[model samples]
Target: MVSLIRSALLLAAVASVALVGQASAECETIYVRREVRDLADEEWRVFVEAVQKVMKTEKPQEADGQAMTIYDDLVKQHLDYQDKCHGTPIFLPWHRAFLKTFELELQKAVPGVVAPYWHWGFDSQAPHHSEVLSHKYYGGAGQGEQSCVPDTPFKDYKPTYTADGMPKCICRQYDDNGNRIAPFSPIEELASIVENSPDFDDFSSRIEGNPHGLVHNGIGYGFSSMSSPSDPIFFAHHAFVDMLWAKFQERE
Candidate 1:
């Protein structure tokens, strides 16, 4: 009886250790080769499969009454956190750490998935801008107008560069100093509320009163802005940002 009890406890201890190992395996920082960027279509499909597998491991949460899966939920949460924390600076690292898990997982699942940076070489060309504007968001820029057209093709085009050297898909109409050419004022319709709402201050204040963060505004470029999801480069830009955040946290 004594031997059996001792053996049972040993098994329980081993099981606990295995569980801990599995939990830690959820995600980690791993690098994918640049060659993965040039993968053939069939190979790319396999890569996607691997990414799906890792996503399965993550088990991202879902929004109520919405069809979003775990991966979608993770991206949504990180985007919201970035919106709130971007200007504050300290939270940048935290948000980046959150992104890294997804990056590593995707890379792990899809071997040789090359994460590419934004290729704005396509941007410096006039014809390229014309091609982009024809899509949707750029149409609002009006040719030769003093409006801001982002480097990326996303909607609500706000151009920004991540501290880690990644160019954000967001393009805004600002001068070289990052000042808005046309300020976005939610208070145009509610001047009274805007003037009195001491609790609200900042670009994303509209998000605070927003029941849904980006969802209500539509995630990733807005409909009036970019008409589709972020370009493939978005993942790489975010991955670099996420890596930066992990490094930043090490110091904190």
Candidate 2:
């Protein structure tokens, strides 16, 4: 009877292990993120609305003894963790978490709204003409002396938690009289970035230096600043970078 009981217990343990493995395997779910310009009309509307909603919706996060909006919190997270992100080995992973957090916050505003990416590679040759800069989207380079965004859905949107902790309009200063759109990382360069790197270090540096930097610099001053999250395009740009990192991982 004792031997029989021992055999029964062993069988139960094995069964439990098998069940856990099955659950783990089934837990994998793939979410496809579409590019901004490729979103369906309804999807585009929802994405834009969700972004605007998140920027204005206040949450219970700590901020100088005042509640801050989801946008504020997201910006603060990036600004505070700048050390862990820029010019570091953790740049890719750090921004992945940042993008996911931003996505979750956006979904809270509009269920099923996915954070769209800007395929800078597609716009590498002529970024100014990319749908990403259209009036319907994030807007183009700033117009006048102040370099404030001329017009867009977010033209008047203000981010209060900027570098000076004061409200400010989004601005971009494309160098050389609006002619400096940094070509970004072309399609071929993107392919090389993912497939040619010898190790994680090389991959991280190459990505951060090119596609990422090129996009930020191309976007202009406000985006190049530490308070880049102030610009809605910042999320889309990072999303693309995050996607690139994922592709590299898959290749590995």
Candidate 3:
């Protein structure tokens, strides 16, 4: 059992209630997670604005002597405990709950909004062409010294931590020359991987590797670190991952 203790200090006084108080005792409320492209302009605005707001909001407690944003604190949790969560069956359940915590924290700015999914499969043919990589969303690959992304709203953000501990920028190293991001695993391949698995372990192992790695490797060089949550897209990317698991459950 991976210890939940790793995250026990996460806004414990503020989020403890959100984590438990909002549980539907009888399972009555159904929340919808929308695809990023499908969101209405206003809905997209709300989501983006909320993310920016939380990026600036302080955590109740300083986790690293420096007062980090709620976003970075979440990142630190992964840095502190990724070994227990990834490359194991627990990855699925651990991230599922972790995503929930992210959504609740986001609610601090946009009460009703949940994370959105990136259906990268649609852009599999040419990932650099993805609007998500354009200034419209998270912005394209980094440029210049440190490859600091200079287009996304986060361009100005100096996240407190990184694997190198010095980027001071969310650095995505997409060569962006049509080849940096190889074609994503085909959607049918992803669905098939999920659909063909006969049981939990089978499904979890298959889904966690290919397409999962595709999402991370294809575009998030900035995120393969202890401070990955510093990039807001991490949660959305995982939201789509979680949806695939939900699809498998419904299929079974």
Candidate 4:
């Protein structure tokens, strides 16, 4: 009887081990989005390529009275929902969802692609001089009247929608009164705002008021308008904003 009992106990233990192993194998690993600064040159290349693909690919279905590219649809969505999504309780959550959707779309174009956050805190000191503004990257400061964007991957690329209700080339103006617009709010400033806010409402207000507003305004021209998402950097900028909110959540 003792020998039979030992055999039964050993069989149960083996079955348990097998079940645990199977469960472990079936679990999916979750991926965390990284900062744009952390992306390698090759990774940045892949991301840029994916963005271009989405920009050039036309949407198969006309949802809002026109056939548009995936990129144009995103711009239109932002324009349509701007009032509901900005400066309200839904602001953070709405943007978070939007970022996730955009990231997924990007992945569909380029497998394993993830949207990267721009840590503007690091670039706040001298944003106009930041490497992200290089000709090899998003492009340099605008030139000529109207502050038209020049010499970048997107210089010649025109968007289907604009703030004025017409199609136009990507436009940006980094200068104001003969000097680059003020540097964006630094990380230290952002930390102070997040740490001081007593609730979600205050936190959202403070964030939208400063760094968020500062970055958009500093970029000037197209970036300053309601259709700001037309600029590719808009995604990276907002991703960091979302990260800041996540940081605030952790502390609370």
**lDDT, each prediction:** 0.34, 0.77, 0.74, 0.76
Candidate 1 lDDT over 1-252, as tens digits, reads 133234434543442343343344544645543233345557545654654554345343345455443444444454444444444423333333444445555666675554432222233223223232334222223222332333323333222212232234332222222221121212232233333444313212432233112211222222112211222333443343333223322332
Model 3 C-alpha lDDT per residue in residues 141-179, reported as the tens digit of each score: 877767777788777677866776448887777634523
Each candidate structure's TM-score, on Cα atoms with residue i matched to residue i, is: 0.35, 0.85, 0.85, 0.84
Candidate 3 CA-lDDT value: 0.74
**Poorly placed runs, candidate 4 (over 4 Å):** 1-29, 63-65, 165-167
Evaluate residue 1 in candidate 2 and report its C-alpha lDDT on the 0 to 100 scale.
Answer: 19
RMSD of 4: 12.9
Candidate order by TM-score, highest to lowest?
3, 2, 4, 1
Please give the distance, in angstroms, between residue 3's alpha carbon in candidate 2 and its true position after superposition: 49
Per-residue lDDT of candidate 4, residues 125-159 (tens digit): 88887777777677766777666677667665578
Worst 10 residues of 3 by lDDT: 8-17
What is every candidate's alpha-carbon RMSD to the true fold? 16.2, 10.2, 5.7, 12.9
lDDT of 2: 0.77
Clashes of 2: 0
lDDT of model 2, residue 24:
40
Worst 10 residues of 2 by lDDT: 1-10
Q: Rank the candidates by lDDT, best first.
A: 2, 4, 3, 1
